[model samples]
Target: MKIRASRISDSILIAVSGEEPDPAHQNISRSRRLLKLIAAFFSLFKLLLTRYRRPEFGSLRRDVWCLDEREYFESFQQKDPDDSARGQGGASQQEQRSQRGKGKGKQTARLEPIGDLGYSGSTFFTTPNGKYLIKSLPRRFEYKFFTRDLLDPYVNHMRAHPHSLLVRITDVVHAPHPTLGGLLGVAPTHHIIMENLLYGRDAEGGRFSNKWETYDLKPNDYFFPERDIADGRLAPKSVKDKLVDEFHDHVRVSAANKRELLRLLEADTQLLADHNAIDYSLFLVRYPGPRASTDDGADDAVPDNVPFVDSDASPWRTGLVDADGKWTYRVVVLDFFWARHTFRAWALTSLVKSFNKVAHKGPMSITANPADYRQRFLKMIQDIVVEV
Candidate 1:
């Protein structure tokens, strides 16, 4: 398999073939190139298809700054009901003027804008205090394209369920413009502000300490370990226990942590059981280390066996300043557009790898004691599966 970088998008197009054709053979060379081109085009097409297949709440543009942080905050303040200048209700002229001044005062502590904070459509911004993360949607897309009535019910279910890991929703803000291009036809721009992951890192961060190293894994590389365990070639007990201990440690150290992840997994299963969503990918992220000073240009090394402090449940609950200033958990729901297919299993598998890497130094050690932890984790996962 060969990967080619695309000039148009951040995604890389892949070309996988059975064997490399002989360069000396003109016909074989031409055929291989053609095949490669076709593969590349198809891969890019598939990504676009995936983007359009779901409702786009924001731009798919690779560049950040599509949504400016200060503008987003200004918009939110303008629309907030509590604001005196809020246009929604009838406020006296004096009240509106007073509120405007107060709102301006509140804006005094604004931080610099964050540009490339997300993996996909949205960009994340934090306040100076690091208590809230603003996920700004694009200003061009239709709101209905991404939102559904199911969201409220789904969120409520997660809140009510003891085992759900879903993040809490605090407030929803409508932007002045649609975040998606050309899709906006009088649809207001919008953003969802909710509980940020308070006490944990993203799934990907947990898997590998180094960013470049994690991307080296082929598709098959991710699945082979589980296959070995299933076939009895790998010890299941050992893996399970290690996973359990790691999860326990992650929760114990994190603040405002709850049994939410387990519950969210269970809720996902139920959603799948009822044919409510589609399977989608999810990942976790961690801060590499303290910011580099002006005098030092070197990347901060993530310490080994360092106990992380999870400050909040999600980034939305915290702010941009909080993310940069402190350690926190931000559980992002990547596949909200296709809620009909739940990717609980894949997520769990990924989580297993992630937690083990961060908690146990590498792949989880499936020793006798580790096996017990493994069983507990498995049980938690199984209970969710059964619920689904």
Candidate 2:
């Protein structure tokens, strides 16, 4: 007998023995079974290769891309028993083990709920070390309508560019609900751990009271004063003029800071635009205060009675804190949920409006080098839009 082999398809081969069996007498059913067996074996081989391709990245294996045993079996239900039996049992078992391992990984890092932080059904918690902010799905709901994976890529982007205007996403973990007070029927939650800014207290502490007297504020300046008229010592209009004039000088210094800030914003905007992830709703929180000097040491606290101003004379400082109440003047960027390609215009426009409301006063003009400030901001936005 002579044996000859020939390629049938990319994944199939046929081997024939002897010169050729009589076509009329050929065992057609047997040949068909043999062909089916070859195809099934090839399929199983491909499945194994895909399953073990990135075993270290367990999430990839358990994700929807990989098939479960039941799904695989159901897909090939019409296959012959002998062909399906060849490696089905062993392959199925291995797949189950791979998925089991992934599930175990998720359960071990379960996130504990710390109650509502703000947005509906969005809860906050601290990691085991209590150093990071963990945002997770509500414990009371099963179906999450929001995109959890959207945050993963944003976190990765921030980690690569830590000093960018964007907030930093520290880590991501898979977690399960606490047994008690847990939301019913909710699946294992994916918790995003971020650098928590809430731990730090503003140097001025709380919103500035609008009723406080602004001896230096003009009739048109934006100044928050205490509402209660306990003391009739409102300064005379002449004194207010002197204060407003001096305040305008401080505004000059503030314009310089704003110029620097615009530069930072421009750079960040370009980077985000390049990535094609721009969302106009994205707003950077401005921490208005004098930049802290390292020489000032760590124990510096804002004096309670200092007059509010945009310059270093003002006590408001932005800082970060650990769970133990320790704070530092480190700037952290956060909240990338609204990042998208079209968001730059809205974000920049919002910032401009805010500056106008809080910092800009009288005649809609920049006091300290009007031409320079307007030119810088316009250039910044132009650069951002072009890059995007």
Candidate 2 structure quality by residue, lDDT tens digits, 1-388: 0110001110010100011235786656987967754554443111101111122222321331232424222221122234321212222323433443566411112223465542334556542222235564333221121133344443344344434444433333332213211223222233444443432222244343221212111122223121112221565444333222222211122334445445555555454444333222222122223333243333453322332111111111233221222212233223333322223434644655676576552222112222332344335333322210
The 10 consecutive residues of candidate 2 with the worst lDDT sum are: 8-17
Instruction: Give the alpha carbon lDDT tens digit for every residue of 3-82 in model 1.
Output: 11111111100010011235666555777867754553433211211121111212111111133223222322223334
* Cα lDDT computed for each candidate against the true fold: 0.32, 0.31
All candidates: TM-score: 0.35, 0.31
Which residue runs of candidate 2 sit more than 4 Å off their true CA positions?
1-114, 127-130, 137-160, 175-188, 202-260, 274-333, 338-388
- Which residue segments of model 1 deviate by more than 4 Å? 1-99, 102-106, 117-119, 139-146, 176-188, 198-264, 272-275, 279-335, 339-388
lDDT leader: 1
